[model samples]
Target chain A: MIGVELRKLFRRPRTWATIAVLNALPVLVAVLLQLTDLAPRPGEGPPFLSAVLTNGALFPLAALAIVLPLFLPIAVAVVAGDAVAGEAQAGTLRYLLVRPAGRTRLLVAKLLAVVAFVLVTVLVVAAVGYVVGATLFEAQPTGGTSVSGTSLSQEELAGRSLLAIGYVTVSMLGVAAFGLFFSTLTDSPLAAALGALAVLVTSSLLFTLDAASPIAPYLPTRYWLAFVDLFRDPVLWRDVVRGLALQGVYVGVLLAAAWANFTTKDVTS
Target chain B: MSAVIRTTGLVKRYGRLRAVDGIDLDVRAGDVYGFLGANGSGKTTTVRMLLGLVLPTAGEVELLGERMPRAGRRVLPRVGALVEGPAHHGHLSGRANLSLIDAAGPGGSGRTRRARIEEVLDQVGLGGIDRRPVRAYSLGMRQRLGLAAALLRRPELLVLDEPTNGLDPQGITEIRELLLELNRRGTTVFLSSHLLAEVEQLCTRVGVLDRGRLVLQDELVRLTAPTGATVVSTPEAGRVRAVLDGRVLGVDGDRVVVRGADPAEVNARLVAAGVPVSALALQRPTLEEVVLAAAGTSADRVEAPR
Candidate 1:
């Protein structure tokens, strides 16, 4: 079932289009940064955007930081939202259920497929950012030093980049699970996608307000940028752990609710 | 013969509306059982329950001697079905859709899967167009593809709901012949339809449903057997109508339909009166009339068969 689901996910042209569009953003940013020849001062944008101006290796981290808050999550939302509702809207749910795919198994397959989509999307963006950044920027300055003024080995840079990608993947799981829950509740893929986006937007809105301080830490979007802490000299673990724990709660609760509601659904479509 | 499908006092309710009232069915192996009903008469609902797609509010369903839902996983592989209509991804080719469904089932090697997919496509007359996107196919072609998917596993029992709903006359004939051929190969077929003529011609046995209840069920031969009225056709119909007196049920052009009269006696009476009957025949009610009478919507005022 997982094999079949993955095959379906990859076969659609829309899937590739979404990936291409996402990767294009980082390429555009690299070009603009090269043409301007003006590096952002500290704290102007995401944690690594300023650093990428001198050292091209850091651009993958910068691209992830720029997209993680909105673009990546939205891309994950679209795929996850369509996971179940798309089948229902196409009137194929009845045929699938009649095959006795077993509601639980089908739901699990869809969730895994969404997770796979998230991983692929994030990696493609990072890879594109790396190539564009390398082409446009210098690997080492004339003084033979990076912005941090410390020479890092190739192995360490590779390891940290992978960790950054892993963290981003985990953070997006909450949105994926939320999208899937909405997918089970409705037959329209567009409605499901919008519904999941509404929840994320509301969470982000609350996170920005001082009045929402009491509930801010629990919001799904609160610690999304914690991946930045990975590139810090000592690697801060405080908010990173919190982010993982909070995402765990979201994934657990939302997936449980999705399964409970979907198992007993009438499947009239 | 062993029963292929048996339902005991099955019921399903959506809030206060009882979609399927308590109904018992016995579909024996090797018989083509036509489940007949009007548009909203609960035929689709019952088919859903039997396939474990919808849980019944009350009662039990047994398929191939095993309880449903609990045994759905164990039993579904042996059963192939096309519920409501052909539901598939519009963007996928006909071959791709079948391959996906076949892969979702329990066990099949890649070689076997490919061979079976090709074989069923050929059987359904979709040989060369297997690679075409399903969205480009016509409604009749989709119906054929649906049938092809159902046959991919060479299932022991085949269930189809209104398989010929939107088909033209030629397409309908093609489906009827395919179903008959499959049945001849020892597949037990259970189908639902509102078309009385289709069922009368294709099914050996039938169960008629009306407004969430089973009104009548019997062998097709017994149900359509001559049981009421004798029709007498003659050029002198105006004269024959007078002799038959109150026995005449109604006058239909040149034919005088009479009730409770033997064909020989009616012939003698008409000839003796110099009516010169050209044709004297017993009137066997058609399946359509039987269904309408059972549904209590008959306009011709035919007597209900006991």
Candidate 2:
């Protein structure tokens, strides 16, 4: 099932198109940064390139932010949302359902496929951003300067980069689960994808409000970029734990609702 | 014989319209049972219910002796279905679509899967269709591919909703032959179509549904057998009706037609009644007539089965 799903993922033109566009955004940002006088002057132990490194983190984050509202969640929704609905629309649901594999097994296989797609997509953004950052900024031996007046060593920076990327991956998982849940609700992949994006965007908007501060921390959107704290002199585990926990809750709730609706749907349309 | 498929009071409603109203049906093991119904008469809905793809609002369904919805997983392994229109990922090659389902179970190594695929494809006359993308396949070829998928698992029961739909004459004949061959090998076949001729030629037993209700269910031969033959001799028509009894047989015009009496006996009774019968001939209702009478519509309802 995984092999089949992977083949399906690669075959879709939209999948590759999304990846290509995402990979280019950071490079474009890198080009613009190179042309402008936005960095610290050279000969300052750390040159202008190093100054951009502080901003390098933003490339992936920005890419994610822009992509999340329209592309990331939509991508997740496109793949996961089509899990059952697409097959139903294509008339293949009956064929798959008749197989020896149970419905739960089929759903799990598809859900995992969506998760795998999410992982690959997030990795693409990380790889593209890192490569572009390295090429444009020049290699720096040090990690990054911490927010609390401390500097991170080379090894520490690599660790933080990995941690940050990992956190982003986690955040994307919530999107995938939510997309899969909507996929079971409707026969249109576009509808499912858009629906998941709508939910993510709505929740994200709510998270940005000061009035929502007390409850915002509990939202999945709130934890999306929490890994930035990992680069701090003393890493803040509070936000990290809270974010991971919130994402887990979202995944659980979404998957549970999906399973419930799927098992009971009449599936005529 | 053990029933391979059975349904009791199965119902499915879409808002106010009951797409599949209360229905009770049975298909015996190794039996090629024809489900005769017009479009929107719930044939597709019923098949979806058996496959667990559609939930029923009320009643029970059992496939291969296992109750439905609960035993769905266990029963699904033994059944293969093609509901309504044949559908697949248009961008993928025919082989790829089957491979997706193949990977789902039986755990065959790549070589085993390829070999099985080849065999099924050959069986369906889709031997070279594997290399072509589904988007390029003709309607007939797609139907064949759908059948090939169903045959992949060597299922004990095959539920095909309009298996011959959208096929040319040659394609139709080929599928009919293939289905008969499969049945000969002990696979129970359950098929639904609006074509009475196809069902008459292929099925041993049949069930008729109209407006979501199973109004008639019986063997094909029994349902299509002549209600009774009419013997006409202007004056003896009424006398013939009297001899056979008005309830069992009646005179219409110059002929005596029995509603549910054997033609031979009715003829014998008329001869002994001293009615000068000018003509004595047997008339048996065709499959179309039975279906029409059951459906409560003109013979137009028998348009085409697949």
Candidate 3:
């Protein structure tokens, strides 16, 4: 079941199209930085944008920051939101259920496919960022400076980049869970996708409010960008670890809810 | 023969509405059971519940002698179905769609998956079909593809709803033949359709559903059995009416319906009376008349409340 679902997801033209579209913004940023050499002042724009002008290796991390706020989450929401609702809308859900494809197994397969999409999408962003950043900017292949102004070796830089990618993937899993949960509640893929986005929008909104400070730590999107802490000289694990734990809770709870609702749903479609 | 699909007091309620109210369906092995009903008589709901797609609000569903929605994991793999109509992923070719659906469940061995897809496609009359995406298929083609998917596993029991819905007359004939052939090969068939003509031609046993209730269930032969009346066709209808006298129940055009169970006996009496009989046979009601007399008004019709 999982293999079949993965084929369906990857064979779709929309999946590749989404990935290509995701790389567009980061590539555009790299080109602009190369032509004009006007990088954002330190800590002003994206996290590593200023540093990417001197060391291309850091540009991948900069690229991750560029689309992290809104673009990547929206992409994840659309795909995950379509997971089950899309099948229902297309009238195939009934057939699958009758295939004796146990409802629980189908849901699990869909979740795995969504996770695969998140991983592939994040890795592409980082990889494309590395290529564009190297070709467009100056490169110090030996090592690069960390966010804390401490020099890090090439191996250390590579390790942190991978860690950052993994962190982004985990954050996106929370978004995917929201989309998947909503997907089970409706037959309209668009509505499910929008519903997930609504939660993210609300969470981000509350994260910025002083009155919501007490609830900030509990908000799903509050620690989404904590990957920036991975670039600290000693690797500030506080916010990064908190973000992972927070996303873990959200993914676990939302998936459990999704499984419960879907397994018992009347597949009239 | 053992029962293939059985239900006891199967009911599905949508809040205040009883979509399927207490229907006890008994479909036996090797029988082409026709489930007859109007548009809103809950036939589709019934099949959905049996296949575990919709849970029954009350009562039990047993497929192949196993309880449903619970034993579905073990029972459903042996049953194939086409509910309401056929549906498939439009972007992929028909073959691709079949392969994916077959792989989604257990018992579909990967080594034989390709051969299985080809065999079912041919059975549904798509043997010469190319790799064009199903989005480009006509309604008839799509319907055929749906049947192909249902037959991919060679299930022991086939549950089909309006199987010939989108087909042309010839296409309909082809599917009926295919279904009958499958039935002949030891596979039980539970056919749910509103088209009386289609069911009359294909089913051995019939059940009529009226407003979520099974109004009639019996052998088609018995329900449409000889009405104990002999129909006589002759040019001199008046002479036959006068000759039969009290036995002549009614006369229409050149035909007369007289009270007699045996056509041979009626013919001898007509011959002795010097009446020329063109055609004489024992009368039997059409399936349509039997159903209309047994079932209530069409569920789709709504009359103003007093």
By DockQ, the best candidate is 3
lDDT of 3 by residue, B1-306 (tens): 788888999999999999999999999998999999999999999989999999999999999999988988888778889998888988899999999999999878889999999899899999989999999999999999999999988999999999998899999999999999999998899999999999999999999999999999999999999999999999989998777779999999999999989899999989999999999989999999999999989899999999
Tens digits of per-residue lDDT for model 2, B1-306? 998888999998888988788898989987899999887787888888888878888889998999987887677767878878677888888998888877775434567888888899999998866476899998888888888888887889999989998899988998999999999999999989898899998999999988788989898888767545543544556666566665435557776555544545655666788766666655678888888877865323556767
**Which candidate model has the greater TM-score, 2 or 3?**
3
Pairs of residues clashing in candidate 1:
none
Cα error of candidate 2 at position B145, Å: 0.8
What DockQ results do all the predictions give, each relative to the true complex?
A: 0.73, 0.46, 0.83
Tell me the TM-score of model 1.
Answer: 0.94
Candidate 3: residue B63 lDDT (0-100)? 93
lDDT of each: 0.87, 0.76, 0.93
lDDT of each residue in A155-253, candidate 2, tens digit only:
877777678768877888888888888888888877888887788788888887888788777666777656657756799888888888888998999
- Among these predictions, the greatest TM-score belongs to 3
The local lDDT score (0 to 100) that residue B137 gets in candidate 3 is 99
lDDT of 1 by residue, B1-306 (tens): 999999999999999989899999899999999999887778999999999888899999999999997898888888989999898888899999999988875744567988999899898888888477899989989998998988888889999999897788988998899999999989999999988888998999999987688889899989889877899888877887689788888888898898864898888877888888788888988988888878855323456699
The digit string of per-residue lDDT tens for model 3 on A27-74 reads 998988888989999979989998888999898889989999998999
